[model samples]
Target: MADFDLEALSLSELKKMQKDVAKAISTYQDRQKAEARAKLESLARDLGYSLAELVGTATKITRAPAAAKYRHPENAAVTWSGRGRKPQWFVDALAAGNTASDLAIG
Candidate 1:
């Protein structure tokens, strides 16, 4: 976050800030997910599982629990799902005209 420049923005200036921030967050998350896939692939190769097998397993998505059964250390607002698209709630909030930061972990 130190790399982020978020100083001196009026409420009216927040629109552009919001757009930049959303893109930045999505890019960062995508990087994390790709890294996770690569690590898993390397481990699979070491254990005799083919990259194809590892990738197939990774591509499958699992639904989150009904309540708060997950946690994210970085930002409580950001839940942990092994890295993917924004969760449904976040998408809904965005669609309803709320910024990502408007949501919280707890």
Candidate 2:
């Protein structure tokens, strides 16, 4: 591994370096996964079984539909599923003295 003097790099140079490192890591990970898949396929062939037969084929991920849980009173378009972080509109409304239940969808 080449030694890098991080302290000598300017802020912009450091950001560029960070992006480059991230991209390199992503590329390396993808290559490693492909190689692993190839090796597994080869082994499966030798064992008289297709890769899909050995490891079941990929299944479609099914998630229950997210229903609107909260909506902006002023704008119907602004709504939240209430699953993750509260949206900015919801926070603002709450700060403006509106309770969470007030925004609940029927």
Give per-model CA RMSD.
Answer: 20.8, 7.4
Off by over 4 Å in 2: 61-106
> 40, model 2: CA deviation in Å?
0.3
CA shift at 16, candidate 1, in angstroms? 0.7
Against the true structure, candidate 2 reaches a TM-score of 0.54
Task: Give the clash count for model 1.
Answer: 2
Against the true structure, candidate 2 has what lDDT? 0.95
Question: CA lDDT of 32 in candidate 1?
Answer: 100
Clash pairs, candidate 1, are 76-105, 77-105
* C-alpha local distance difference test of each model: 0.67, 0.95
Best by TM-score: 2
Predicted candidate 2 versus true structure: per-residue lDDT over 1-106, tens digit per residue: 9999999999999999999999999999999999999999999999999999988999999999799899998999888999888889999999999999999998
- Which 10-residue span in candidate 1 carries the lowest summed lDDT? 65-74
**What's model 2's lDDT at 26?**
100
